[model samples]
Target: MTNTDPDIRRKAEEIIFGMWDTLTEDERKEISEHLTIEEFQKNEYIYKELEIPKCIKWLISGKVKICKSGVTGRDQILRTIVPSEIFSFRAYFANDDYLTSALSFGHSVVASVPMTIIDKLLHTNIQVCRKLIKQLAIELGKADSRTVSLTQKHIRGRLAESLITLKNSYGLEEDGYTLSIYLSREELANMSNMTTSNAIRTLSSFATDKIIAIDGRKIKLINEEELKRISENG
Candidate 1:
């Protein structure tokens, strides 16, 4: 991995550690000294499944996908990581290797601080400990909800939920209806826990019903309310 420019590293630290203002000067300095920043190309793997956990990572820019290989070698996308979000700490905390792999969705910049430093902060700062615990709890809740949605929801409902999730995570383009992020049909299927063909068919059905419009990979929501209703009813 190539080292990031100092200016970029400083910017990432400001955004990521802005929430940890409670840390003392020495603690902050220690973190800065140990943090490493690297840039990843589009579709690159930041880390792979079964890799030993080394650091807590922050997505300084671009998007990341957290996924695991399914029984048939298909990938099941668990979540998308947005800019400034912290990740890759769960495995370290659990004393296990990474269960899922992290891949860059586009050209991305990531910053990593050693887990040992995080352990120190957790020991020395009560607030830091509480914040990390709260983050873990929130992630756990989302995982549980997704598990139920994938297992119980029909194909239409699952696809609707995935579209809603993307909109919520990345927002819409300037047109205000088209999704900002363009994902391939295979990626959509992985996220919804369905086959790519099923996702494409369901998306077409939505367009035919006037619930959405498809322009190549760009999906424009025509009836956001109806989509939400389907997701909720499922």
Candidate 2:
């Protein structure tokens, strides 16, 4: 359902404000006027694979995962989205339907503006075009790095890298050790490109080695340096 609440619109505008200094007063006003906000429950699909792009989306709160369905009917996680990050626009730029689906990792709020609006801005704003190009380049670099890690890393290294990726993406709790985001073993397996049992076994091995501590879905890094070494050696 779409939310037209003024407060939500204001919050969305505020998040986008500092992202692009090239946005003119008029462009900002236009974006604010057309923005639509929506709330999604955990595990809900924000957009399905092969769907046409209608809007450029921003994560206002909570987390989202971009994933593609593998041949074996399992989904492989591509990337995780954090608050204030823009998503779902790559397909628009490519002139194709989405290759991967986006799912809410938890209860989430998202803000969107029509792609038509962004296209108009891009045509008239050189700075906006450059900024978007830079963002695309960064995303491409990350994709390349992940591809190498998943294809070449051992089970222990893959699991350790996944944990570190989660930590870097969402950070840790106030305790400074427990990861802020809690993911089930299945989700961890998908992110690491391994079987659920393999993921669990590797995690158990890490705990036995004093590399990490696990409590249900929560994982605390016990020896972050060792974990990094394993990831680097892989």
Find the candidate with the highest lDDT and give its number.
2
Each candidate: RMSD to true structure? 1.0, 1.0
Give the per-residue lDDT digits (tens) of candidate 2, residues 1-234. 576778877788888877877799999999988888999989999999999999989998899999999999999998999999988998999999999999999999999999999999999999988988998999999999999999999988888899999999999999999999999999999999999999999999999999999999999999999999998888
Tens-digit lDDT track for model 1 on 37-143? 99898789999999999999999888899999999999999999988888999999999999999999888899998999999889999988898899999999999
lDDT of the candidates, in the order given: 0.91, 0.92
Candidate 1 residue runs with Cα over 4 Å from true position: none
TM-score of 2: 0.97
Query: What is the alpha-carbon lDDT for the whole of candidate 2?
Result: 0.92
Can you list the residue pairs that collide in candidate 2?
Answer: none
lDDT of 1: 0.91
